[model samples]
Target: MDHIIEAIASALNISVKQIKNTLGLLEEGNTVPFIARYRKEVTGGLDEEQIRVIQENYAYQVNLEKRKEDVLRLIEQQGKLTDEIKADVMKAEKLSQVEDIYRPYQQKRKTRATDAIAKGLKPLAEWILTLPRTADIEAEAKKYINDKVETMEDALQGAKDIIAEMASDDAQVRSRIRNSMEKYGHLVTKAKKKHTDEKKVYKMYYEYSERVSSLANHRIMAIDRGEKEKVLNVSIDFDEEYIINWTINKFTKKRTSPVNYLIDEAVKDGLKRLAFPSVEREIRNELSEKAHEASIEVFSMNLERLLLQPPMKNKMVLGFDPAFRTGCKLAVIDHTGKMIDVSVIYPHQPNAKVKESQRIMLDLLKKYPIDIIAIGNGTASRESEAFVAKLIKDYNLNVSYTIVSEAGASVYSASKLAREEFPDLHVEQRSAISIARRIQDPLSELIKIDPQSIGVGQYQHDLPQARLKERLDFVVSKAVNRVGVNVNMASAELLKNISGLNASCAKNIVAYREEHGEIHNRKELKKVPKIGAKAFEQAAGFLRIEDGDEMLDRTSIHPESYDLAKKILKELDIKEEEMGSASAADKVKEASVKKLCETLEADSYTVKDILDSIAAPLRDYRDQYAQPMLRSDVLELSDLHIGQQLEGVVRNVVDFGAFVDIGLHEDGLVHISKMSKQRVSHPSELVAVGDIVKVWVYNIDEEKQKVQLSFLQP
Candidate 1:
């Protein structure tokens, strides 16, 4: 345990006390979120993410200790546990180092070493690693030469092969090799356009490749897209000499032998055959996993912000899923997000009469009292937006329309839930309805579907299946937990994602609530087995039980906290009856914080986190970004005769260009050609997702809805 703590402290650059405290909190049934948020005094104020890192390192340290113990046991059983070996074992900090030290003593099944030992050449390989410059080294090999040493070319070659295998497989050598490869190897990828399909999605990646060391998250994803479609080949590379230095340094530093010449050649063969490919793959995979995690984190953060973005609220919205072949699917969603009505019109159908469809939309707009018409900005989307624009202007309707992201709406339409929700509706209609509902309540509706289907992650499908499932499940759980669930309406799938509420626990919570009445107070949750105080602690803040027995009960305020809150209410001369909705609850919360601060007698740093966590205490403890918007407006796609001033949103940033949404349903291209006024090699230098900027509409293609935009104007 002490060794594990030391290693964790070394790896993470934190004190042993911090690691021990974090582990203590973890052991005491506190979650990372709880320990990080509620136990600030216990953990010395480590944030959740920092605590998570400590937790990960602690686990790694534990595994390292177990591996060390296992190595000692295995060597002891082999009867090689000499006093010296026992002493060496005591000093091993990590599993890899222990494995390296135990390399020669480990049991073997027929390898080059076993073969060499059988051929009476075991000492020769040892001599080579020792680097002894004896003049009769060739003579020593001559004595062991034989038919089994098949092809100098015979004995020398056999000894060299055995030594290379031993050196390459030496855990120390491999670790060093891996480290060197990661530190020096360049991730290389290239276009394989010869086998490409123009019909495939992500055609932009047909000619892309970049080094892993310098690759950003978006670039890695782009290369992954290319490789996924068989349009690119990727690999990691580094200078051969660099790999040699790492292995030789470990070998000479550890061994007493003078085997420089032999070890050097052996390293070449070892790396060329084993270490290079394996280490390179590890480096690439680690990089990919890191990038994937970052991408998912960003997506999760963005989705959380988008979900919490004020809903258009009780206002009916018109959603348009536009297309050329099947026309458009339009749905009117009332404030409650029930599909009040749906219609199919042919405004974009090339062979149809456009004027007739225009009248249909105008009539619906006036009838529904719509607040916003969310147009799916996909193929034929701009034309449909144009059609809707003319309708709003012609009818003199007061409704506003905003383009909606239909990134994975099509995938949702084909899903079983979509099929069940709108059994009789056409696929296009299902998609349109989804488009509308996403705008209505993104978190509520999105929780019902798969995250990968939302198109925010990188290589989500290509990820290792088990790893992907674990990570995606984590993301879903965090999202569900962050946005609080309605006990009555949540699907089992959505319910299962609540923190500490697995499939079975979620089912029981629902079952218990259903079998009885609604959960009057969170204390009733104890009736469900395995949902003791611990589970409730993690799950309560994120679950909403509307109109519960207590005024604070319906909100995020934990029941354990009700007494303190009641005292505050009495002190403020306020009744529980008066503190119910958003405003009243907010004031009561502020008063409670003041009282709690006085009670705890701690610094704001200590008391603030706890107070903020006393159920929605009026402030969202979780992070939230500001809503994205354009700085300026582009009135028309064609108004840019050459250089027209426009405002745009940085929708998607890439190495090539920043795709900016400038009022058009289609996001225009700000090709790397015009990302900034300064010399820009990469678009990310001056912009990123959600940057609102003034850009010049450089080129307009009315036929394609592809307007080229630039940061600099002529």
Candidate 2:
């Protein structure tokens, strides 16, 4: 346990005490969000990400230790465990290292070496290893010739096979070779001779070569996808002769020995046939694992930002899901995300009833207090935007429009939850409602869909699905917890993402709310089925009751800290009802945190948090982010020109750059090189999803409808 804690501490550059305490909290069934938010003092104020890293590292360390024990016990049972072998196994930091050390002792399938050993060639193989200067190799091989080994050549070959397998099984040699490949190998990809890549999606990788150490994570995933799709043939390129010669030098001890040739041949054969393939596989697997991790991280960050986009509060939004033949679907949703009206308009081709569509839209605009239009960036979106722009200009309607990524609207519309929510509505109508709700409350709406379907990162489909899901779930949970949920208003989907609530618990909370009416305070949550002591402890702080019986419940103050909070409020001579008032804020601001900690006998972290919560009981972390871009006009691909300046919202950030929506059907691409004047490792360093950025159109490809943008004006 000490060793695991020390290793995690060293790896994360955190104190051993902090790692130990954090691991203890995690082992006690506490969630990362719970530990980060409620137990800051115990964790030394470690953030959610830090605590998650410690938890992951502790799991890895525990698994590694268990694997080492299993390997040690297995070797001991075989009566082959030695002090040095045990030491090597015990000291291995990675599971792969321990597995490599135990490879020779593992029960393998039928192989040339095992076959040779069964034919009395083990003695000959061992004798050959001595490198005797004056030995008759044929005569020695003749002794091993029997029914199984018919000829002297057969015996010699068997001996060589045994020696080859032995050399290949050397842990140090395998490790050295793996390290060398990782450091010096090049990943080479070529277009397959026969493939159906008419779009040339992998054109850049058709004849690509990159150093394994320097390849970007995005490119790795792209190449992997291309290879899987049979568009590219990928392999590692390395100096094979150098590696073979190195292995030969390691095994060869005498220059004048008669059996040196045999040893050389055997070492080469071992590397080429056994060790090289296995090491290549390991290197590729390691690279893929790292690439998946990086891609998942990018996906998670983008998803978090997209989920945390500030709500377009108090605005009645019209969700416009545009299509050509099927007509554009429209649904008017009130500020509370309740669908109040639904309509359809054929604004584009085949059924180009422009006048009728205009009449329908204008009537809806007049009937409802629709302040803005949330147009889905799907088929016929550009035409729909143009129509809306014309209506606002021609009739002079007091309305603006913005493009909402309808990436997952269809999926959500077809979901079981969506079906239950709007069983009478068609799929498109439900999609329209989802689109409007996404603008009003992105966190709540997005949690209903799979994170991978949100479409904010590169190559999400190619990523490891399970790992990607885990990471995305964590991101959603963190975002949901950061922005506290109103239990009375939250859906089961949103509640499920709260700190300690699972799907079943969240459903029960909603059921309880439905049956017994709105929960008036934090204490009422315990009455809900499945929300026991631990669940309440983990979840209560993040579940807000804005107009609850208890004012502290409206804030993020945990139930356990209410007494202290009340005492502090009394000390400041502020009433509990004045928690979010100007007078309360002023008083809390005037109170010294150091004096309060001393007086109340509490930790400074909790005191500061309580004071801040008092200043604004219903503080939203999402309010700090820029709202979604609302535009009164639309830009066309044909209207774009070089050097034109525009304001755009960053829709997605990737390894290469950020895609900014500049009021066009196709989002503009701001390449990494054009992100800034200074050197940037990744585009995320300069911009993130949801950021409203000013960019210049450096180049425009009208043929492909691609706009190349730059941060600096040309």
- Candidate achieving the largest lDDT: 2
As for candidate 1, its clashing pairs are 130-257, 130-258, 130-259, 131-258, 131-259, 132-258, 151-154, 187-212, 556-615, 632-647
Candidate 1 per-residue lDDT over residues 165-229, each given as its tens digit: 77666766667666656666666665674765666555555444444556776677766667777
lDDT of each: 0.67, 0.91
- Over the full model, what C-alpha lDDT does candidate 1 score relative to the true structure? 0.67
Off by over 4 Å in 1: 2-25, 28-48, 72-114, 124-142, 145-153, 170-278, 419-427, 488-494, 504-537, 545-548, 580-596, 599-637, 641-645, 648-659, 665-714
Task: Give a tens-digit lDDT track for model 2, residues 1-714.
Answer: 898888888888989999889888988999999999989999999999999888888888999999999999999999999999999998898999999999999998999999998888999989988878799988888888778999999999999999999889999889878887789889999999999899989999999999999998888888889988999998888888887887777777535689989999999999999998899888888888898888788889999999999988899999999999999999999989999999999988898999999999999999998988999988888888999999999998898898888889999999999999999999999999988888999988989999888898787877889989888989999999999899999999999989888999999998998899999999999999999999999999999998889989889999999999998999999998888899999999899999999998999999999999989998899999999988888788888788999999998898888999998878899999998888999888888899999999989887887899999978
Considering summed lDDT, which 10 consecutive residues are worst modelled in model 1? 625-634
Estimate the TM-score of every prediction: 0.78, 0.98
Q: Which stretches of candidate 2 lie over 4 Å from their true place?
A: none
Error of 1 at 311 (Å): 2.0
